[model samples]
Target: MIHVLVTQAGHLEETSKQCCKMSETTSKHTSALCTMQSLHLVLLVVLTIFVYYVSKPHVTEVQPMNRFDVTNVSYTVSMAQPTDSIQRTAVSERTYVMVMSQKRSGSSFMGELFNQNPTVFFMFEPLRSLTSLAMKKTSFSFETAVHNTLNSIFKCELTHVPVSGWVVKKTEVSTCFNAFEMQNNSVLRQICSKYDLTGNQMFLNISSTLCKRRSHFAFKTIRITDLAHLKPFFVNDEFNIKVIHLVRDPRAVMNSRHLLHEENLDFIRRKGTHADEVKDLCQNMKVNIAYGQHIPDWLVGRYKLVRYEDLAEKPFQVTSDIYNYLGWILPQEVNTWILRNTDHDDDKAYSRTRDSRKTAQAWRKTMPFPDVLNIQNKCQDVMKLLGYVQFESRQSMRDAKSSCIPFNGYLNHI
Candidate 1:
C-alpha cells in the first residue's frame, strides 16, 4: 500500500510541472506579440508626423525690427535732385542703414520714400556687391564703403530731400548677376558701419547729428539671411539696424507671389533676374524665422507694420507716419509724388495690380489647393499670430471673412 501511494505522488508532481511550464510559455509569447504591435504603432505615428511636416509649405513671421545696427549715425541729409534718390547708393550722415527684408516686401520702395524726403537722402540697395564691382573697387566691403559714404552725405545735416527718377549710376542685382557670363552675384550683403565706433556696442553715439538740430543722415539696404547665420559678428555700430515691418495678408502675399512670376515657380526658374529674386525672397523669409529667437524687442516698434493696401489707401497718412517715425519733416512734395505716381486714386488699378486691401483676402481663389494646404500646415503658428485663418474649404473661408473679424489683430496697426 505504501509503494502504491509513492507512485501516485510522483505522477501528480509530473502533471503539475507540465502545467506550470505551459503557463510560462504562454505569457512569454503574449508579451512578445504585444511588444511587436506597440512598436509598429509607434512607427506609424512617427511616419505620419514626418509626412505632414515635410509635405507642408514653409512660413515665417513678418518681423521688421532689429535691422541696421546704427551705432553712431542719423538719417537726415540734403538732396535737390530726384535722380539722387537712394535708388543709386545708400547714404547716411556717417554710416549706411542696410534695410534688410524679403526681396519684394517693398524694401526698395521704402528706400525711395526716404530718398524723396527733403531732409533725408537714401539710396536703394546701394553698396551691393555688383555696385562694388562696377565701381572698379577690387575686393570692396560694401558694408564698409557705405559707412564712409553716409558719413559724407548726411554730414551737412540737411532735411526734406527730393527724389526723382532712378539712376543706373550704380550696379543693380538685375544688371550684373546673370547666367552664361559665369557670374554669381547671389550674395547681397547689407552691413552698415560707422567710423569712430566698434560694432560690438549697441549704442549709437551720434555727436555729429545729435548736436545738429533737425539734422538727419541715413542709408537703406535689403537682405538679412546670410547675416543671420553668421550672428557671431553682430556689432551694434556696423550691424544693428532699425526695421520697418511691412506686412500684408498671406493670401495677398501669395497673390503678389503669383503676380511676380504668374504664380509659376517653373516660369520663374526659366525667366531672367526674377528667378534669383524669387529664390532670395523665400530664402530670406525662412532664415528670418529660424533666427527669430535671437532678435531683440527694440526692433519691434522699429517695425512699422505698413500694409501695402493701407499705404495705397492712405498714402498721405502712411507717408506722414513714416516720416514722423524717422523724426523728419513731412513735406507736401512726397504727398504729391505719391499721388501722381502711386495707385492711390485709381481703385481699378489698385484691384487689378495687387494694390488693394482686399487683394490679400482674395488668395482663397488664387492660391492652388496644394499650396493653400501647405501654407496652412506649416505656417499656422505665424499665420494665427498675424490674424490669418487657414481655410479648410470654400464654405469655411466665406463664413470666416463674412464675420469681419481678424484672428490676431494682424492688420495696419502702424
Candidate 2:
C-alpha cells in the first residue's frame, strides 16, 4: 500500500511540471505577438507622416505679382478690409508719378524735383535690373516685365519685385539711405530702425514700410521709349498716374551724351556716322513730341510735357507750373531745395554743379559749327514747333540766348 501511494505522488509531481512548461510557452508566444503588433503600428504611423508631407502643395519662392502677361488688360487691386493695426495705417490715397525720358535727357535732375519733397518717395532707374530678370523668363516681353515691376512699386508691394539678385543689389541696400534720399528723413529712418533692415534684406522688401506714409510715389525711368507702353496704367482706376514727359533739346542731348561717353552716343556711333546719328536723334525727338502731342484726351490733364531747358532756366516758374498742374501745393522744403540746387555758379563742363540757366546753353558754345548746322537742318521743323530759334551765325548764338522764347503751345492747348 505504501509503494502505491509513493508512485501516485510522483505522477502528480510530473503533471505539475508539465503544466508549468505549457504556461511558460504560452507567455513566450504572447510576448512575440505583442512585439510584432507594436512594430506594425509604429510603421503605419511613420508612413502616415511621410505621406502627409509628400502630398502637401509646394510653395513657390517667386511672387505672383512679378509675372506679367502681354494682354492689354488693366490690373486692379481689391482693397481688403483692414483686420490688423499695421495694415490700417496705410495711406488711403496716393499719387504715382513716372518721370519718363531717354538717356542723358536730365531725367535724373527732373526726378529730384519730385524727390526733394518730403511727401514723395522716389525710386531711381528701377528698370535697370529688368535685363537680368528678363533673361530668366524669356516668355514675357521686356515691356511687360517693366510694367509688372512698376505695378509692384506703385502698389508698394515690395515682395512682388524679383529679389533674387535681380532687383536691388545687396550693396544698394547698404547704401540706400543716401541712394534713396532717406538720410535726412526721420520717418523712413524710424521705419528702417523698427524693421532693423541690415542691408541684407531686399530694398523692395523694406520699401513697403518706407513708402507707407508717403503721399507721392515717384520713379524715374529711361527704358520707356513710347508713352503708349504705359497706357494700361492710365486706364486702371486704382492708379492716379501723372506722367512727366521730360524732354531736352536734341543738340544739347547729343552733346551731353557725347561728352559723358554715355551708352546712347555709343549705340548711335555703332549704328551709323555722326550725321546719321544726329538725323536719327532728330527723328526720335519728333516722334516723341508727336506722341506727347497726341496723348489720349482722357490723359491730356494727367500728362505734362516739360522741357529740361525750361525747367533749368526757370526753376521756380516751371516747378510752380508743374505743381499747379498736378494739383499739389509745392512744399516749402522742395522750394528751398530747388532754389539751393539751381542757384549754383556756372560750370562749363558736363556736370550737375552749374548755374541752371547757364547749363541750358552750354551745348551751344561747345558744339562745333558744322555739327550745329547739321543738327539744325535735321531738327529745324521740330525745333520751330518746340519754339527753339536757330542761330543764323556764331555771333547771333550769344544774342539768341537772352531772346530764346519758351514753348507755350502745349500750355495753350492744355
Candidate 3:
C-alpha cells in the first residue's frame, strides 16, 4: 500500500513539471509575435511621413507691396492655386527703367544695349502681352493692365504676368526676346526639369530668381502711347523710375513699317492712309516731347529723349550718356556687343545686327520721292522738333552726301 501511494506522488510531480515547461514556451512565442507587429507599425508610420514630404510643392518668397496707387486703373491679381503660388520675399531696392518707343524706331536695338548686360534684368515688349489680353477681354483697362503686369514683374513675382503662348515662344523666355537670351540656356532647362514643369511656368521660377539677382531692371515697350499714362508709375516711392523716350524720323518709321506690311497694327485706325498714319505718329510724338520739355517735378532728371538717328550715328556716345544718366557703369561687354552688332548686316526684319549708319539713311534711298514728300508734309512739325531737314527736290532727297539730319540737331548735345 505504501509503494502504491509513493508512485502516485511521483506521477503528480512529473505532470506539474510538464505544465510549467509548456507555460514558458507559450510566453516566449507571444513575446516574439508582439515584437514583429510593433516593427511593422513603426515602418508604416515612417513610409507615411516620407510620402507627405515627397509630394509637397516648392515655394518661393517675394516682397509684398506697400502701395501701388494707380488712378482709374483696375489691375487684376493672379489666382493660381496655393500649390502653384509664389510667396513674397523681403523687398530689396532696385532701379526700374522703361525704354518707351514707337515700333520700328530702333527700340529692339536700343533694348539690346541693356539686354547684353548681365547686371541688367531685361524684358522685351511685356506690354505686348497686355495688348493681346486687352483685345480678348473687353473689361480690361489699358492702364490697369500696364500697371499690373509691370508691378508684378518689377517686383520679381512672375506668376501674375499676362503672358500668352506666342509671347512665350517669341520673347526672352524660350529663345528669349529683346533681352536675356534663353536659347540653349542650361539654367532654364535645369529649372524646368528640377521643378517637373512645362510651358510658361517653366520660365516663372527662373525669371523671378534672375530678376532679384540683378541690380538694374530694364524693359522695352511700344504699347504705352502717352507719357501721362505712366504718371502713377513715376510717383511711386517704392521704385526709382527712369524713362528713355526713343523717337525716329517719321519717314524712316513709315518706310520700315511698310517693309513689314504692318499698317494694320498702326496705333491710328482711322483712314489708314500713309499720310494719316504719319499724322497720328507725329501727334503722339509731339505730345510726349511737349511733356518732356515742360518736365514735371516727378519727371525731372528722370525723363530723357533719344532719336534713333542719333543713336545710329553715335552708338557708343549715346549709350555711354545713357548709362551715365542712369548712374550705372558701362560694361565692356556692352561695348563689344555694340561693335559686333553695328557693323554687321542681317536681312531679318527684327535683326539687331546692322550697319546702323546705313540703316538710319536707308529710308532716303528706299522710299519713293512722292512718299517722302507726303511724310515730310505730314510730319514737318515732328521733323523740325527732332532736327530732320525737309528736302527741296527729288535730287536733293537722292543726294547721299548731303544728309537730312542737321548737325546742330537737339540730340547733338546728348
Flag regions of model 3 displaced more than 4 Å.
1-92, 165-197, 263-275, 407-414
User: How would you encode candidate 3's per-residue C-alpha lDDT over 236-284 as one tens digit per residue?
Assistant: 7767889999999898888899999754443632233454667777888
Candidate 1 lDDT over residue span 1-414, tens digit each: 434544554555565455555656678766565555555555655665676677678896422112233332433332122223331232223222344554344454445565454443344443333333424555655444434443333432212111110122333333222221111111111112233222211111132233132223444444234343223223333333444555444554555566655443222322434554433444445445433334544343343445544564555777787666655567775666566555432333212133434443545555567766655566566555445556777566655245222432224431
lDDT of 2 by residue, 1-414 (tens): 434544554565565455555656678766565555555555655665676677689985421121111121112222212124433333336677888887778887777677677677677676766654555554757788778888777767756666532233444545344433343233344444444444534334445544544666788877676677778888877678888877778778778878875445323322433447666656666666775667676476787888888888778888898888888889897788787777786454433445777777877777876777778888898777777778777777656445454646333442
Give the candidate number with the greatest lDDT. Answer: 3
Which has the greatest TM-score? 3
lDDT for position 65 in model 3? 20
lDDT of each: 0.42, 0.64, 0.70
Q: Kindly give the number of clashing pairs for every candidate.
A: 40, 0, 9
Q: Is candidate 1 or candidate 3 better by lDDT?
A: 3
TM-score of each: 0.44, 0.67, 0.71
Where is the poorest 10-residue window by lDDT in model 3?
Answer: 65-74
By lDDT, rank the candidates, best first.
3, 2, 1
Using TM-score as the yardstick, the better of models 2 and 3 is 3
